[model samples]
Target: MAAAKIKKGDRVIVLSGKDKGRTGDVIQSLPKDGKVVVDGINVHARHTKPSQGDPQGGIKRSPAPMPVSKVAHVTADGKATRVRFEIRDGKKVRIAVKTGEVING
Candidate 1:
C-alpha cells in the first residue's frame, strides 16, 4: 500500500460526493484498496430477512467504503487539511499541511 495517510479512528471531512463537507470518524481502512469506511458517510440501505440476532433485519443502513482521496484529514481545530510525512525526532510523523500540526494516526 502507498502510505495510507488516514488510519482508523481519525476524524475526516468528505471532500466530494453526497457527503461533501460532512465530518466523521474513520471506522475502517482498506490499505490495499485505498479506501476508507467512515461512520455516517456513504451509507446505504440493505434489505435482509429476519435472522436470529436481528429479528427485524429490514432496511439496515451501513457505511460503504469510499476512495481515500475523497476524504481529507481534520485538524485539532476541526479544519480539513492535507497530510504530509516528515522525520521528527528520529521518527516519521504525519504533519497537517494547513496547520503544520503533528497528527497521531
Candidate 2:
C-alpha cells in the first residue's frame, strides 16, 4: 500500500463542493475509498422514527465523507498546500509543499 498523503487530524481546506473555502480538521480518513470526513464540513441530516437505539431519534446531523481530492492541507500561515513525503533521520515524514515545513500527525 502507498503512504497516505492526508490523514486523520490534518487541518485541511475544502477545494470544491458547497464547503469550498472552508477549513477544518480531518475527522476521518478513508484511504481505501479515497475519501475523508472533515469536522463541521459536508454535513448531512438523517431523519428517523423513534428507534430502539434512541427513544427520540429525530434529525441527526453529522459530517459526511468527501473525496480526498477535494481537500488540501493547510500550512501554519493558513494557506492551502499540497503534501509531500520526505525521508528525515531515516523516518518518512509529511511535508507541506508550500511552506516546506514538516507536518506532525
Candidate 3:
C-alpha cells in the first residue's frame, strides 16, 4: 500500500482558501488523487433532480474536494503541522512534526 500522509478520521486544518484556519475531521481519503475531503469544509452547492429522499430537489450543500496542499494535520497539541513517518517496532507510523506524537488512524 502507498503511504498516505493523511487518513480518514484525521483532524485537519485548512491552510488556505475560504476555509482557512477551519478544522474538521477527514471524512474521506482519496489517496489515489491525493485529495481528502474534510467534513464541513470546502462546501459547494449541488442541484439534483427529485429523488425518493427529497422530492423538492433543491440545492444541497456538499463538500468539494480540495488539494492536499491546502490542509495540514492537526497534532494533539491543537496545532496544525506537517506529518512525518517513523519506524517503531518494525512498523511505520505517522508522527506529528510539531509535537513528535504518534497519530493513530
Candidate 4:
C-alpha cells in the first residue's frame, strides 16, 4: 500500500466533472476504492418513501465518493498542488509540489 496523498480534513479542489474548480474539505477517505468524499462536492440526491422509522421521508442530498484522481490538494494560495512525500527531521511529511511547503496533517 502506498501513502495517502489526500486524507481526511485536507482541503482539495475538484479537477473535473460538474464540480470542477470547487474546493472543499475531505470528509472521508476510501483507500480501498481510491475515492474520497468531499464536503459539499459531488452531491447526489436520493428520493425516499416514508418509512415507519421516519414520519416524513424526502429527498436527501449528500456528498458522494469521487475518484481521488479527480481532486488535488489545495495550497495556501488556493491553487491546486500535487502532494509528495519527503523526510524532514527524520519524519515523513507531505509536501506541496507547488510551493514546496509542508502540508499540515
Candidate 5:
C-alpha cells in the first residue's frame, strides 16, 4: 500500500460535496479505499432496530468516510494545501506544500 498523506489527528478541509468548506480533525484515514473520516463531517443518520446492547430502537448519526481526493490538509495559517513527503534529519516526514511545515508528528 502507498503511504497516505492524511493521518489521524490531522486537521483537514473538505473540498467538495455538501460538506465543502468545512474543516475538522481527521479521525481516520483509509488509504486502501482512498477515504477519510473527518470529525463532524459527512455525517449520516442510520436507523437501527433494537439489539442485544440496547432495547430501544433509534436513529444514530455517525461520521461517514469521504474520498481523500475531496479533502485538503489545512495549514497553521488556515489555508488548505497539498502535502508532500520528504526526509529531514534522516527521518521521513510529511509536509505542507505551501508552508513547508512538518505535518506528520
Candidate 6:
C-alpha cells in the first residue's frame, strides 16, 4: 500500500457518501484500511449507558471513518483538487495538481 496523499490536519472535501460536498479537516488517516476520519463529517450516533465520564445516558455524536477515496484535498483557495509531489529546494513537497501550490510543509 502507498502512503495517503492527505494527512491529518489537512482540509478535505467529501466527494461521496452522506456528507458529500462537505469540507473539513482531517482528524485521522488510516492508510492500511484506506479510510480517513474527517472532522464533523460522517457522524454516527452511539448510545451509551451512564458511566464515570458521562452520567447522562444518551446518544453521542461522533465522526466515523470513511473511505479515503471518498474525499479530495481542499486547497488554500477552497477548491478541491488532485495532489502531486515535486522536489523543491532539495526537499520533497506535495503540491496541488490544479493550482501548482505547495501543500506540504
Q: Which candidate achieves the best lDDT against the true structure?
A: 4
- Enumerate residue pairs that collide in model 4: none
Stretches of candidate 2 exceeding 4 Å from the true structure: none
The models' CA-based lDDT, in order, is: 0.93, 0.95, 0.91, 0.97, 0.92, 0.90
lDDT by residue (tens digit), candidate 1, 1-105:
468799999999999999899999999999998999999999999999999999987888999999999999998888899999999999999999999989986
Q: Which stretches of candidate 6 lie over 4 Å from their true place?
A: none
Determine which window of 10 residues in candidate 1 has minimal summed lDDT. 1-10
lDDT of 3 by residue, 13-98 (tens): 99999989999999998988889999999999988999898998988998988888899998776789999999999999998988
lDDT of 3: 0.91
Q: Write the candidate numbers in order of decreasing TM-score.
A: 4, 2, 5, 1, 6, 3
Per-residue lDDT of candidate 5, residues 56-97 (tens digit): 979989899999999999988888999999999999999899
Model 2 TM-score? 0.96
Candidate 1 vs candidate 4: which has greater TM-score?
Answer: 4
Question: Of models 4 and 6, which has the larger TM-score?
Answer: 4
Worst 10 residues of 3 by lDDT: 74-83
Q: How many residue pairs in model 1 have overlapping backbones?
A: 0
Q: What's model 3's TM-score?
A: 0.91
**What are the TM-scores, per candidate, against the unseen true structure?**
0.92, 0.96, 0.91, 0.97, 0.93, 0.91
lDDT of 6 at 103: 87
How displaced is residue 97 in candidate 2, in Å?
Answer: 0.6
Cα deviation at 90, candidate 3, in Å, is 1.0
